[model samples]
Target: MRGIVLFFCSLSLVACQDPAPPPVEGTVKYTNAQWWLDGDFAAGERCAQDGLLVACPAEPSLTIDLEGGFVIPGLAEAHNHNIDNNFGFTRMNPEYLKRGIYYVKNPNSVASDYQYVEEDIARPQTIDAIFSMGGVTIAGGHPEKLYVEFLSQMPAYMGRDFDSLNSDAFHLIATEADIAPTLDLLQEQGAQFVKTYLLFSEEFERRRDDEAFYGAKGLSPALHLALTQAAQARGLRVSAHVETAADFAAAVASGVDEINHLPGYFVRDVATTEEAEAKYLIPEDMANLAAEKNIAVVTTTIISTNFYQDNPEQLEMVKAMQVRNITALKEAGVFLAIGSDNYMSTAAAEAQHLVDIGALEAHEVLDFWIRSARRVIFPARKIDCLQPGCEASFVAVSEDPRLALPLPETITYRLKQGYELN
Candidate 1:
């Protein structure tokens, strides 16, 4: 009877086993395309397996006849907001993917909203990966003010104050006690980096003319230093959002890994007609120090938006100041990375702006996204290039981006992890 019972249990276990899914179908090869390798195109037959390239087999399993197109490494958007809905555009919109921006680093967004959008929303086929830093800033700081709309939408914490709820989206650190726990919580929530904000307060902004209030509301140097140390101890990179020269200096001095936004916003009162010209100067010494310390800067190019506005004189002034500031940073050997903020299609524009200002060459601008930017975002892995052993992901274009005058119009095709995008 015991043997019969054991036989029945074994039969039940076998019955519970599910059938294997069908094998993935498709050959993985692109022919006649100029494969970008080591900053130049090379002719070679490439093959991939399980999203990574292995030694090419003599008889390929799959082959795509490209008939001559430029195959370059996938592009990364270093600074972005993964808002659930941004002016009617969802986070995984195909428009972004079509432009060859296969990866995005969303620095700040409501955690619940980000998780909801990421899980519920149908992502575009072209998206290779999405990294979130989780909600960032001190309690009642920059993003706390900016993301009011998103925060209001969360039902669990709606109508309650931000301080009362232990939220995943906004890791609000009001004191030194909040730093380690916040970093740990964010790490548990899959945050790849730590994002901190250094924006002027409304009261401080109102009293900008008063010299005493320059560093009044933002993160104190001591707090910044402590935060960086804690984050580094946990192996997370610290990227700070700073607008003014003072904020930039503080961020660098505190040992933050990267600085966001150009220095013009706070370096001078660009809006104040009387003082704009007087304050239009980049702190060359700070640039030198940042370079020596190996801290990178993300030029979001908020200044370039002014060029399209009705203020021609302001545009000219801003353009000149941007050129000067970027030149100084480049001369100091600062690792400049590209970030569009909310402007999704502006990476090319930012690159062109750098080239127009003579700060970086076309290839160097490409390298910002291809190589330098990837190093900042994915420090543990090398996935930004098309070399063997790198992840099998790239974008195909009709023209070489390096040679194209204003960058290629759009990506003709994209592949992520050896799978062709629809």
Candidate 2:
């Protein structure tokens, strides 16, 4: 099954779960549509078959006049977590759909925790949530530090043991021996993708002996390659979390399907340290290699906000390095996907941050957020455009979102699979 579309009201209907089925045959017309076309807005008429776009039919039926509404493809969150907890889905999931974000990727959520919220995801009323179940990391990996920091900031879980949370969220693999077994376990847990941690992999060996660096260390190069190869052999998409430029290169060398963020985006300590700054700047050759291999890099630069809170100067330096990295990737022609891996926010924030940093203008960010993000989340699906053979899904707003700065806070309407979501 592809996903939940509204109930069939006419000639043909596909079952809810079929991802690729024979076309459904009801046509709906959207007129006076000021929609994104050829990288810019163009006034046009659009048509849809039930749950799919007929895009340019000669005689489309069931016309609905937009009366000056602006339409764009639904926005997507290519990376996010902390949306699958028992108490969080109800509180957080709707915010995506309400914001017209139709797809979300939880790259490293706990499988056991997913059982608590899976019922609400991937349904018609909910955003299409894809989960990696858990991530593959070393004995003590980066996310442990993230969890500690999260709890420290919240103060609610200050002294409590969160070992089980760590256990469920990560599959620890220290050697080649752990690769096959971990893949099997991930498949058993119904992981949508395979996530691996390459956090500062170049320093992993040295850090292994240091307790202070426990949560900062990740898979060694050999083990990282082994795990990624095994997962790819099983036809799984491998998304890697990387820190420094070395980590990015290692993840690339492992032939991972996606890199979760640019190398220097979240690094705060590098701005002042000349040697450290050099270490995080991505090389042109490496970016070119990633582009040649067709590896997608998700932009989670908004994560920089979580650091350098009191130092604007350091933050600017970090952002300057981030921009250099983004420019490198762009020049190398690497496919960039917008995502907010920041636990406290959404991809919308990431898109806005991209604009605020001058990495991209408002129109470019809006287009990328609406058009590029979904395909990154589901490369095999036809959901990127309002073109023929695409899914009949789109978000409409009262005015052009490109004309504004913070993106639209209100969505006029939503139509998914020929069904009115609003």
Candidate 3:
């Protein structure tokens, strides 16, 4: 009887010590919660809240206390000009980098693009290595057609063409046919998504057709369509550099998923000719269309004001348009992703600028930024917010992000998949 009683006691002890059930399998909760989620409330309900993440009810994970600080998604710069930001073009002088700007998006400030390539692309591996190291994902631009233009701009570096440079340094698909080839290369190289060059207005496209622009190397909408179709076939969405409304319209009409910048500049007629063209501002109709279609817009609102002075007029325009555009989309149920087009050292500064310029409410900008990044980086995956069965991605910042704080500093404390990087 004593032996049996002892055996029963041992069994009960073993049952009680079952190791807390493995932490509810993938859950992280904010200790001092004051974060408000805006996009897709259903999605937010799954992962974001003040209490313990219900999914992992039994987990003993780290508690990130923001001291009632604001929590939002990690920001993404969807329409960023890659070559310019990482290659030391914006702040440095490279003659070759400048020449390429006429044809390609120049990241260096130089006279000849050939020299730019020599100085920058000579160490191709170094270029992409920086992006990988940034703890951020990017949509890289192709460097082929622009290379031809670079050659024309600088005959000295012409001998060492784009193909001669390390293709590994950048993803260089120039045409529709190049899509599959590029995808294969990226898959082998482990790229997240593909980026395209400037969108041409129907008028500009016609002009190019007349000149057979870029020596007949310029990509047409048809080619773009083909590339998008191929990329989507391989589960990739193309991000095009759109400047005007026509470009935006064409991108939407082509059935691409997202527009890299705001469509305000694109939809207007900046033609120098006296001709009757259809006027298309950021029309309420188009906003509705975007919402109904569920097409995502990455409003790099902060960067848009970078070129134009943030005067009262521009600020008011940004404010009204942002409010109307965002409100319209929200009313129509459009998904908006926020990004700072200029991914400079002052990244967070740019976010503050967005609020200052009235592009978004102080409280709501973070969610928009995160959603934008998630949409472009992972168009297919439903992984924007923290939720059960969702990829764990969130940020913890002190105080509510929506309210304006003096010289605000946001500290990002988390990354996707639950790695505490505070």
Candidate 4:
């Protein structure tokens, strides 16, 4: 009877594959394939398994044809609003998930823009539909866009203009009482991290101007502390838009896990501020604070390239600042992650920008990019490299991203969850 029971269990195991075994897309091992699994420095070396270029020594076999090209981990967007980005027209299909940018944040769309949050975001089916579009993880929330409707219909209680409204706009964020339930709903819907864009309200701006209430009321550090604690209680992480020095410092004090966007408009490295009113100035000391606390910085340099688009000089300046910060952060031994922050552009462009201006070499950039995404979903393994037992997530760029300018024509072969793209 025991033998019969064992036989039945074995049969059942072979009959079911609910987890969905990974499809064998293809196998690739290249003698000339420049491979970097998230921070490995083995550049210009031959890699193979069983005498092939890149083979799955242990797998339900798949093969890929690199044709003497290069392979690296796929890219990620460290700070992106895919919903807002999808609004404008662009050359490429912005939502193409194959490039292995399988992660996104705040997928707001035209529907979400027009619909009330309570109606649109409060339902599980609606949230699941948004997630099913192929973002494995997303930043949980979105702040109001600078829409004319929001501007024209600014609440009577709120003040006028972008500055006045944004300064004290903690009201925009669901309060501590609301955050817990909202986060609970998000977790049920598979959200990985909570995100909020920083925009101040008129009251906040006014208080900022006044000495007595430099950081009080809705803009108080306590609010962030509350938010962070709430997220922590539920094992969620927080990512915030820290565009200015004051915002960056406040975010750090509140213990936000990661910072999106590069730190510009802040004091230069190893420099002191002479300005009497340094409200938004991020001193060098803040960098030290971030480093000591083990906060990862996502370098969205490529996104900034698109910014100041009309102003060539300003664009160039932002790029220069990125280069400097990348170097500074690396030297400081801070973990760096690469995010495209791109909307409606080819992955080639995003990857190329990182190689072109950032401090990382081609292979290192690939590792940084993937590691960021892995962190987005699973922060525990902060430094996930291409090692045994790791999830197979990589990309095959037609050429070495470090040396060659990623031509729009060059194809990027994406591999995620052990399945290669068709």
- What's the lDDT for residue 10 in model 2? 24
Tens digits of per-residue lDDT for model 2 on 43-153?
A: 887888767777566776567888777788878888887475654566556556667788888888767768778787776556777889878887767666655445334
Candidate 3 lDDT for residue 275: 22
lDDT (10s digit) by residue, model 3, range 1-422 = 00111111221111111111222234455555444456422212223322223453555345445555444544443443333322333232122111111011212111222334344432211111112111001122223344334422433233654444334434444455566666676555444455544444554445443544432222456666676677668865556655545565666655666666664532233452112123323556666776666677665556545444545554455455555555665666666665444533223444566677665676566555556544555454444544455544445555455564222234535433343333
**Can you write out model 4's per-residue Cα lDDT over 163-231, one digit (the tens) per residue?**
442312222344467566555555554555555443222134454335443222233355566776677
TM-score of 4: 0.62
Q: TM-score for every candidate vs. truth? A: 0.78, 0.86, 0.59, 0.62
Candidate 4: stretches off by over 4 Å: 1-34, 37-65, 83-100, 105-142, 145-178, 181-190, 199-219, 265-281, 305-310, 346-351, 354-364, 378-384, 405-408
Window of ten residues with lowest summed lDDT in model 4: 132-141
Q: Which ranges of candidate 2 are over 4 A from the true structure?
A: 1-26, 55-61, 145-167, 268-273, 403-406
Candidate 1 lDDT over 1-422, as tens digits, reads: 00111111221111111222322354366678788777788766566667776676677777777668788777766665533333213423454455666666666644554554455232324343334445555545555443343444443335645443335546666678988788877877767678877654323345434544432245656677788888888888888877566677778887888888766643333466435534434578989999998998887665455334676666666666666777888889998877666433435555666677666678777867676436667665557767668777777887777865224464676776665663
The TM-score of predicted model 2 comes to 0.86
Considering lDDT, which of the candidate structures 1 and 2 is the better prediction for this target?
A: 2
The lDDT for every candidate, in the order shown, is 0.61, 0.74, 0.43, 0.46
Backbone clashes, each candidate = 3, 5, 24, 22
